[model samples]
Target: MSGAFMGPPWQMDWVDTARAARDSLPRRVRDLIDAVRAELVTVEDPYFRGVDNLPDLPEGCRISPLLSTVPSGLHVCHFDHGRGWIHYTFLRRTADPQIVVEEVFWQ
Candidate 1:
């Protein structure tokens, strides 16, 4: 994988699935969730703290930056289940830095 200093914060857009979750969540919680989601999509190498009992995702599952690290040019799109559950999937890259490839979400 390529290496570089963590750049500015980026906003990961709410994928259709995530948007549905945001819409169903409590207002206060939704705001925080949306903010975090946006941050993950826009930046490269965003900071993430670890979460307890996090499930083992599939080979190409998307995860939160708060729970995982995203490398430059790679990104995970969010999908909300409207039950306080969120899921993500790896998206194909468009332009350079358009996706989050590496993650420090456990750090």
Candidate 2:
């Protein structure tokens, strides 16, 4: 069996808010979410690969670990919407077999 479960991160309200505002969000923002969601379906090694940790992040996306904002393995990524970048956090646990999307910063 696959040891991977993709769902909402820690702060679901934030993610929910994003979904609620999807229509108003920029194309790149929507694309970022769509791409992330798609890649998560078949979670494997290099967990964040193709989603955040990729080769030459598509012009608008930038994923980096938020040293102090989260724990050791958590990360914060940015997806640009032409003018600015939307930040969000996620968790990838080695033993849990679960990927949690913590929160998103639209502003």
Candidate 3:
């Protein structure tokens, strides 16, 4: 198992990368991403808070640890906004309480 994640105030790493991806998306897709952000902002830890309360998420969207990457145990918050899925990986730093988003991938 990975080390314990510190609490609250999620942060994103390489935000510009995510932004550029968002900028290239169609407006409808962008709106979906916006909606995900809106939902996420309401909670302190998207990965740990659990998705049971996020009613807006599509069928496959849920918070789960990456199975293939066990031991490292990276947690992901998956959301299917449109035809694609937005997968966010959360990395916890020892010194920070914020969950640093290590990556955001659309697939």
Candidate 4:
């Protein structure tokens, strides 16, 4: 998300992680995530579920890093609509590693 990157303390690790994650995803999923990330950048309020909603995430979901240095704070999200599941992993900071998902499947 562009907005997430702009303003305040800029974190270079996020950019690096986002780029690497983008490159690692399957083509179709990668495209979807690109659009979502762009939307998140422009829209003031992006759709996001809290850790508590991890069980409701769509299926086919996977976790991609968005910040290497703060691995538990930023992530690119993917969901599988058929299964109603979502998957993501982010770092709260360099010290905190968090994994939030609606299901246990990740590939």
Candidate 5:
């Protein structure tokens, strides 16, 4: 957030909106989001979740790629709150085709 890009790592501007939307969701939906996200990160590969090895991603709760390039992995996140898809551009720091996940614990 300190940098000019002001996002995860790719500097996608919509990152702020994404977080805000998540924060404002109902408790039930927010909990569902946590559960789904937990499954996603545990999986080996997120970009190509094969039909055989797909996560428990529900409708209106999927993350799709908008742009995938070196040093930049852009994605479109959707949160269905009955209105429509609240889309936001997001990304993570990756080395080549491999995504680097950094674990953080909060009490």
Candidate 6:
């Protein structure tokens, strides 16, 4: 919500720390993320958007809220099929409709 004007409904971007973490990942895992990114970029609110009360998770990823520190507006999307890696992202205010990647880690 800073002075910067947002352009689209569902834009995807990563903070520097998150970008570094994603950069360190191998190609296959990165491919999973790229796939998720494609889906996320089309959803207006990845954290809250849903249909028929089901969670709106990107394909190949399972999501849960990040509850330790910043509880609200923060979430982790983890690989659902036997993978231990997790990707973190958060949405800003309506004026800045962007999903900002917060972190990436392995569990």
**Could you say which candidate leads in TM-score?**
6
Model 2, residue 87: distance off in Å is 5.9
Q: For candidate 4, write residues 1-107 as lDDT tens digits.
A: 33333321212223444455556767866555544444433332233444543322223544445555654454555554432222344333333222332222225
What would the per-residue lDDT of candidate 1 be over residues 1-107, giving only the tens digit for each residue? 45543344442444565465457666655564555556555434333314653333322234443333434223333433322334343343333333322321110
lDDT of each: 0.41, 0.49, 0.56, 0.40, 0.45, 0.64
Please write out the lDDT profile of model 6 over residues 20-55, one tens digit for every residue.
877888887777777777666665456654555344
| Runs with alpha carbons beyond 4 Å of true place in candidate 2 | 1-15, 21-24, 40-57, 68-71, 81-96
User: What TM-score fits each model?
Assistant: 0.37, 0.47, 0.54, 0.35, 0.47, 0.66
Off by over 4 Å in 5: 1-14, 58-63, 67-73, 76-107
Q: Candidate 4, which ten residues in sequence have the lowest lDDT sum?
A: 5-14
TM-score of 3: 0.54
Question: Candidate 3: minimum summed lDDT over ten consecutive residues — where?
Answer: 49-58
Q: Hey, what RMSD does candidate 2 come out at?
A: 6.0
Pick by lDDT: 3 or 5, better one? 3
Q: CA lDDT of 64 in candidate 6?
A: 62
Which candidate number would show the highest lDDT if scored against the true structure? 6
* Candidate 2: C-alpha lDDT: 0.49
Question: For residues 10-45, could you state the per-residue lDDT of candidate 3 as single tens digits?
Answer: 554435676778768888666766666655544655
Which is better, 1 or 4, measured by lDDT? 1
State the lDDT at 76 in candidate 5: 40
For candidate 1, the 10 contiguous residues with the lowest summed lDDT are 98-107
lDDT at 31, model 4: 59
lDDT of 2 by residue, 39-61 (tens): 44343432345445464445566
Better of 2 and 5 by lDDT: 2
